[model samples]
Target chain A: MNVTVKTFAQLREITQEGCFTLTLPESAVTMGDVITLLKSRSDKWSQALGASAGSENGSVLMARNQQLCDIQTHVQPGDELAFFPPVTGG
Target chain B: MFALIGDADFDQQWLYNRLRQEASQKAKGNVGAIVTFTGLVRDNNADGNILGIELEHYPGMTEQALTNLVQEAITRFSLTSAGAVHRVGRLYNDEQIVWVGTAAPHRAAAFEGANFLMDMLKQSVPLWKKEFTRDNSRWVEVKASDDKAALAWLREK
Candidate 1:
């Protein structure tokens, strides 16, 4: 299966890529699995996706198809997953 | 609820006329009062020396949030019409940044409805502001005072 992944703010800056097309194995089926999979890809991703840093959740927020979702949400082949920092708006 | 997020400066009269037109059309003899609130960019935040600010938002999520907020206002206040617009990008001092307008059968509802829209948008909308001063820039944090203001409204209901 294939998916397009996106990251924003520090994640994007760390990854050096905003979004990209990628191929995923059939065994990887959910968002959590994808995060783990991405972590396996590089140390940079691992740090950026880490559970917490200095008490915050690594300052990354994930969205599947533009809706905020947890890591366990099921992933489809053509899904667009975006990762960004927590919103700071009024 | 209507929201415009971009690099453009919104037309103030255009929005006002648009909201009035929407209220008039939706009224169809039902609405008896319309109230609107507009917030402008000021030179100061809680901290001094805010030269200007930039607004950033999640494109799709921001719209969804605003829609949900407006729907809530309509239901809560029995509103016939409601609209809100928040400008994005670089905004100068004293420039209009946001407007929330509501129409209802009575003055209290209209007033409360408009207030509700602004209050809800401030808390729920996935938008962030960065304030720039003469020497530095910093992200604006959600103040406890804002939360208190929003909470006060709930007590009224």
Candidate 2:
């Protein structure tokens, strides 16, 4: 399956990319699995996605198909998954 | 019915009057109250004297989140109408950041529904704020107090 990943705010700054295309095996089928795969690519990827500082929840927000979802949310082909820190706007 | 999210400036009075006008058609004499809350960009924060703030949002998700919040408020508070608007892009000190409101048959429901929308905006809306001081700019992180505020609403019966 393929997924388009998007990062926002500080996550974008860290990744230095706004969007990316990734091809993953069926076994790697969740938001967390995607993050783990990225972490395997570089040290920066590890910390950026590992657990952000000041995040009491210890992870960035995950959105699957534009709705907030848990990392365990299923990922399918052509899904849009986003990652970013906790929202602070009013 | 639903909310708006964009980078354009808004007229708060126009918004309220519009909501009232729309509700008057159906609510007639029943809508006796309207309540609104506006968030403004301030000059200071823990980050010191701020020059301005920049807001970012995930376009589709933000509108969906706000619309759902308004729907939840209407259902829970028996509101006759509800609306929310959030501004994105660079906003200077004292500029409007957001507006969320509700109209109801009574002041109590209007007040509660307005508060619910504001709280939900802080907790669930996919909008991000970045504070810009003269020297540095940083992404605003969600405060522990904000989570507590949202939790209070959830705990209410």
TM-score of each: 0.77, 0.91
lDDT of 1 by residue, A1-90 (tens): 999898754567677877798788988887888888888878888888886421223345567776666566788989988776555454
Native-vs-model 1 lDDT? 0.72
Candidate 1 off by > 4 Å: A9-16, A40-44, A52-59, B143-157
Tell me how large the interface RMSD of candidate 2 is: 3.6
Candidate 1: pairs in clash: A88-B128, A89-B127, A89-B128
For every candidate, C-alpha RMSD to the true structure in Å: 5.1, 3.2
For candidate 1, give the docking quality class from DockQ.
acceptable
| Candidate 1, B1-157: lDDT as tens digits | 4555556666767876776677778767776887878788889977676888877776776777677778789888998878777777778788878878887888999999887777677866667677889898777766545544433332232
Q: What is the lDDT of residue B121 in candidate 1?
A: 77
DockQ of each model against the real complex? 0.25, 0.51
Write down the worst ten-residue block by lDDT for model 1 chain A: A52-61
